[model samples]
Target: MPSDYHHGVRVIEILDGVRPIRTVETGVVGVVGTAPDADPEVFPLDEAVLIIGSRTKAAKLDTTGNGQGTLPGVMDAIFDQIAPLIVVVRVEDVEDENEQISKILGTVDATGHHSGLQALLTAKTSLGIKPRILGAPGFSHHQPVADELGIKAEHLRAFAYVDSPATTVEEAVVHRNLFGNKRVMIMWPAFKVWDTPLADYVYQPASARALGMRAKLDNDIGWHKTISNIVINGVSGLTADVSWELQNPVTDAGYLNANEITTMVVQDGFRFWGSRTCSGDPMFAFESAVRTGDVLADTIGEAHMWAVDKPMSPTLIQNIMDGVNSKFRELKNFSYIVNAECYLDPELNSVESLASGKLWLNYDYSPVPPLEQLGFRAKLTNKYLVELLEVK
Candidate 1:
């Protein structure tokens, strides 16, 4: 429903390149119809099919030597029952009409739902009728049009952007209230987390157990358990973990038996959040895709323990940190966050103008000092320094 056409295309492309992805079909399919005469259903559906058939047959003399095919009569009955999915656009509004159609098709591309239609069209093209294209999300009126064209409606996978309807005014109000002009990036992992020293040190036992259960479900349902990452631009971003509870009562009941077991699992959820500001840059328009790619790269790097098999060159990280800090300062508004321990590193301290009033987190690690605790110091991490001309 939302503009997801490009994303769907990307998904299919990536999966096709990597491996043969198997997916179970879910939900209902959409219908289609096409017509040249005035139709009622086409009034609402802009992306509906419009088939312009010819009625005049070619002369026998023309066909005798040229092998010309006879033209078939155009049927007016095609418009009778097939609703307004295929509207007769006036020649005058061709530009506006095409723009709307393009937008819908673009949405389909963004969401990765165009594969079925693409396949259908490919098949139809092989038979000689120049394949007419449809948008990713199928509307109710389009079913008959598809039928008239002899294209199977089942080839379409109908999926709306927002599935759940708002039941209460409060829910709607809350949803609207939280909306803002910002960008968001959502991420899903590619592999499951089994064992890692970082998990042992950073996460609690309860957290580890929850991850284990998730991995198990991923295995059962044939979904990958790898953790994903995301990065958002055009708006300041915030990160948080989210989850949703889903269960099937019938399958859940079977768990009570000794031999039968069931686990009511919660699906992990992630959402990129930003305000909806019209003035935001084009990056905001592509925040979802950009962030997804960034996060995926980050997740892969993180999983590899930052080693990445590359030589232990700190140059890239150092350069990124330096560049980000420099840009933050140049912006003259946003505050820069820095880890103080990084400053003490011999490589960073020597750079001229590097130590300016940027915030820092204090950390100390030394084998010689036995009594002094070595970690982030409250003096640095907890305090902020106004930007001054000098580092001190």
Candidate 2:
């Protein structure tokens, strides 16, 4: 959703689309020097916990040359109205500068104030209030500030509204607590493979080793012979017998870049979406293809593609290949293209993307340290090269 937290209230409302529904009752507490003419009680205070910081010293907002008393008394009325979820947002006036001015005016320059609210909300959350803090522009800092305030970052979902900006803390609380039950799930696949007594920690699986070996042998002979043969035959002309040096085993987190995956597939005559790349789940490939054209349906949710990061036995690889192929058959015209970089140990001589010939296996790369920092040698011999390509 587009957000306008950087600007004024009117801009916030204009940019932030519809108003979210406030399902939780929370006391909106804050110390603001200035307040809008509208009463806070008239706002959404019924089920909310409301607390106002009384200014013993005439609030700066009230003493300005053209100032009309806007806050203190209004706070009294708001406190009397709707009882709500309780938390405190303390406002302390720093020196009289633009910083102080913005703070007094509720212009989003209040990190401390926001932090205070996050703390208060967090306390409420601890008590099971599930408080959500919504803030404009500067308030987005709430994420880290909340952390500093000993509050859980996820507990306070921050948002920006450019148009019809929240006039008071109460309004801000309303927007924050109301983001529909819209939750986003981000997925990534772990694609690492190892062999022999679990040689690679990142991709360790005795089962995978057994499975991969079986699959490799079966593939070499004939399982999914049609596709395998086609792929082998088509690229056989470009195959080379050159020995290439492979290096740098990938760590647990490091993997191929998203763009690299897309390019690899497109080059292999497959179409894919950058956003559709799933990390560990192969089913997402089919789901991504199905939702390709449906805008609403395609709003990806709880779906992704990922690589299993264990030493794959030939049988495991075969299972993966078969599973994907079956889904591809159902989807029709779908070609499997993994967007992540294939992992190779440093002991492996080299990777060759040949234009023709048989895939020659020479050196075993499993024995070398996977860490790139251990000082691995780089080889220029070209078996296969990574190329930058356009996303289809």
Candidate 3:
């Protein structure tokens, strides 16, 4: 908007300096599953549907037919903790479990049509907000289903909460070996909840509460906090009793956590007992760390449209750096990160690259990993005894 053609000299205010970087919203849960009793008009098959916490809207997914559908049950679990914006992708439910899983995994046709979990890819466009926590509660225990969750999570830059087929600690460890991806969370030993229609106690997958609790954590605390040690709701008890002692690694809960499997333990109440991702790398060992990195990257990627196609001026470069560093500083002040810095590397921003309209900005950060363990060295010393006597 240069007004240079005017005869009268008009001062055009030039906006300069730090541009605000808007962060992508977190805590939105995206899920793919089947719902036999769900209303077609409300939740059509192979489509992404947005469902807020309206009982009337949620009641459309009725369970009067053949049991409560996977989506209904999963949503119930999530609602127990906190109301969240959920994107649901309902697939065709059939008698054959394998065939149903195939539908859940979905397909991308030559026509660019997406089905099943693939529908999640279109959520941001259709629903206006993408899901940050991904899962398929009843079916995610299968290897193919969990693998699909992983693929969708990486594409969406989200976290995958998966249930393990393992009913015991050792078996859960076997399932843990199957995954090394940082975004994948391994949960075991489904919790038991009351089934109103069936009039009995039914075991719900670990994903039932994991997804809800993650949303609560992202909302209550920052994305850097791990989803462990939080009291779980809407569950009577765990299907199996996993032992726990604060300092006892020999306990089943301790053993499971050591192998990167998250399970429910009966403490003050039923609480999640682990803070690990199924990552072999030490850097991304914790789920909180991986999420911190993802949230930061996604937020930065979605922001900065105004900077695009602008001339490669020193002022533009400084503006970009200042904006990003502003977000980093905010995250640090909120305790999401220990510390961070954004800088343009001179070596990476070479003359050839800048001439070609390519710029590389590097940001280094340390995510606040949860305190998984703490220890103290103790010794029977005469010095401590003397101090106690003198103090008395």
Least accurate 10 contiguous residues by lDDT in model 3: 59-68
Model 1 bad stretches (over 4 Å): 1-310, 314-317, 327-392
lDDT of 1 by residue, 289-353 (tens): 22222222332223333323334235644433443334323322311111112132455344453
**Model 1 has how many clashing residue pairs?**
49
| 261-371: candidate 2 lDDT, tens digit per residue | 111111242111122222244332222221221211211111112323434344443444444334333333222212212122434433343223212222111111112
Better of 1 and 3 by lDDT: 3
Q: What is the C-alpha lDDT of each candidate?
A: 0.23, 0.25, 0.87
Q: Give the TM-score of candidate 1.
A: 0.17
List the candidates' TM-scores in order: 0.17, 0.20, 0.95
lDDT computed for candidate 1: 0.23
Instruction: Write the candidate numbers in order of decreasing TM-score.
Output: 3, 2, 1
Model 2 segments more than 4 A misplaced: 1-81, 95-97, 101-121, 125-130, 133-155, 158-392
Higher-lDDT candidate of 2 and 3? 3
Alpha carbon deviation, residue 328, candidate 2 (Å) = 35
